[model samples]
Target: MNHKVVSLFAGAGGLDLGFQMAGGYDLLWANDNDPDAVSTYKANLGNHAVLGDIREISSEEIPECDVVLGGFPCQGFSLANTGRRADDARNVLYLEMLRVVASKRPKAFVAENVKGLMLMSKGEVLRRIVADFEELGYDVQWKILNAADYGVPQRRERVFIVGTRHDLEVDFEFPTPTHGRKPDSGKLPWVSVGHALGGLPDPDSRHDLTNHTYSKYKLRFNGYMGHRAIDPELPAPTVTGRGDNKGGVVVLHHPSNERRMSVRELALVQSFPLNFEFACNQSAAYRLIGNAVAPSVGRSVAQSLQQALKTAKVAVKGD
Candidate 1:
């Protein structure tokens, strides 16, 4: 963890943790508006997080860093919500990210969002986002990356936008997945819900595992809950950020038990370490876990960025 990084919309510090796990990143500053998320981040990731709305923060107040990263709000662009549109007010938060990168003028910048972003306004939103970075003097590259492909047990698909400063003379290369569905070509098989949540104490067992407790809300008989009774052998479905107040969408059943997966199990499925404490009520915990970018996926991208920067430095020395 050597390079300085400023993270925005850093919900529960999932993306920042991944960059740390990948090594070569020093999380210097992080900002998030959610109180619970900020508490969790400061507790686990250190005191770097500032609780506030990004639109209120002046870029000059933020320190210069090697990279600026954000998993901007995707609620307005996620498929789970039909009202998603390019003009949705939340969609403009990427401009906040753009503001950070433009302010820091870092060597590189990374932005992640729901996979739906690729199809937003028939690709106009995506084009504009990339073009925004280009306007700030970066060479941008983007792709839809699956969490399952990065060793997470959940099948989360996110679009990563990488921008390298033109002076770096190096193109940012997205990381190749270390694991995939087939386990061929030297790749490992996709990790399963069983692999992530197996052997944990039953939700009723009252295990002391952090955030592993069951929610107070009983399962409804209605059709809102999608993908219950998960297959132990396959990757779990995407975790949604919505809470039970909206009749909760992610109701994961235990592979061996009758009860649904606990909050800890859900976190594990998202590739979060067991010891990583998520601070909040049971439902808020779920929302934070669901909203998180898988750390394993973040690490994969961070490692790639490190290599790309190293290559650029070496090339410069050669010249």
Candidate 2:
């Protein structure tokens, strides 16, 4: 963790953690509007997070750093919500990133979003994002990457955009997947949902695991784990913030205890280490986890950026 980084829209420090795991970057600052998210960021990052909306912060006030990382809000571009039209006000948040990058002039940046961004507003929205960075004098490269590809068991796919100042003479490539593409052993293959929470207690053993469920849904999906230990062999189900209130997906409980998965367990699924102390309560933890980039995926992206920067530095020295 030698490289310095500033994180914006840093929900639960997922992207930041990933960079750390990749073994080169030190987080200098982080920002998020959600109090719970900010709490989680500060708790885990230990004084690195700024804890506010991006629009509220002045770039000059931020510390200088080598890389900027964030997963900007995508409500305006999500295909899940049909109302996300071209004119949706939220779509412009990319400008906030452009604003920060233009002001901070970091060596590089990594911005991620839902895969739906590709088709949003018939692709005009994505195009505009690319154009905006280019307008800011950056050479941008983008691709849609999957979480499962990077070693996490989740099937999450996101669009990753990397930008560098045009004169840097750097072209970045996305990291190649390390897990799903190759079998870990000749027989067992990569890790699975069963592997991730293998020895944990069972949800059936605890009352806390069922407290948040609707009685009818609870009875219907009885074996489903909500906030419980999950099957590790499969990539994790998408982690959501609403687990305390509603049943969005199957969350497997530990085999020995009936309670849902703990915050620490959730973090592991997201690829955070055992010691990562998330701020806030269960609900807040869920939100942060939901919004974070998987550390494994971040590491892959970081490797690409590191190489790109090295190449850029060499070209400059040669010149």
Candidate 3:
């Protein structure tokens, strides 16, 4: 059975695309406040994505679905945001996700956030979040997953919290790493930046690639976030929305160390399809791509959920 899904805080539809690629998900509805992200999502994914703040939209407006998916705003829970605080107003956004799950009562729900969430307030924040879901009778589980482990060329790590309705009697298992730093017997080596961006033409030269443009921000090797040079032999570092201390868009140094990776290249590293178009300007495109959950990682998680649900269905039939 194809599971209907309602996506909240759906930035550029990366996670939604992954669920679609997994083949058993139907994106019934999606909501995001960013106009540019909504435009890009509509252009490439579908017209279901709506632009509006989740807080203003009532649960009655959202469609009922088998699953709920969201990667809520993570800046307040991100270590990179030096000003991260337990009291940051944005940190409470997850409660909005919770509010929906409580109202919709989907069979399963998935929430994603920055890795810092696990460490926030000495892990108290995560504990409270889990407890809140459990209060709604869900068997909740959460883990930190690295994007590179699931074929993304970047080593981005994020926390995924999965909850299955208690009555469903299903345990959601996180997907195993298919690629690793040191490949054992069956695993593949981590995809390198060079491998992911192998055939792309230079941004300076004429190219037909969508969003094949780079930021003109001067290279600064001051050992800050976006200024460091990328090693072609290894996975690229996490793509971030902010660059430097001044909060400009992050444009990581190309593997060549001569220039920053073009928007297309960064999107490629995030495992977005080459044909996927960002309907926004260069800076906005960079921010959207940076803030997105890598499509490859999302696919892995979706596939795992599919297996677990199938298994539970079979068990229920037998009973």
Q: List the residue pairs that clash in candidate 1.
A: 1-24, 1-25
Question: Please, what are the lDDT tens digits per residue for candidate 2 over residues 1-319?
Answer: 2667888888877888778767777788888888877776776666777767788888888888778887898766664556777777777777898888888777888999887789986788889889988988788889988777666756677899999878878878788667663655532344565566665444345543311221122322344434444454466666543334433333434323334555556666777766676656555555566667888888889887888787674332212
- Whole-model lDDT, candidate 1? 0.84
Q: Which prediction has the highest TM-score against the true structure?
A: 3
lDDT values, one for every candidate: 0.84, 0.70, 0.89
Better candidate number, 1 or 2, judged by TM-score: 1
RMSD of each: 2.7, 4.9, 2.5
Span of ten consecutive residues with least summed lDDT in model 3: 310-319
Tens-digit lDDT string for candidate 3 (148-245): 99888999999999998888888689999999999888999999998788889999998788899887778877777988878899999999987543
Model 3, backbone clash pairs (residues 3+ apart or across chains), number? 0
Instruction: Estimate the TM-score of every prediction.
Output: 0.93, 0.82, 0.96
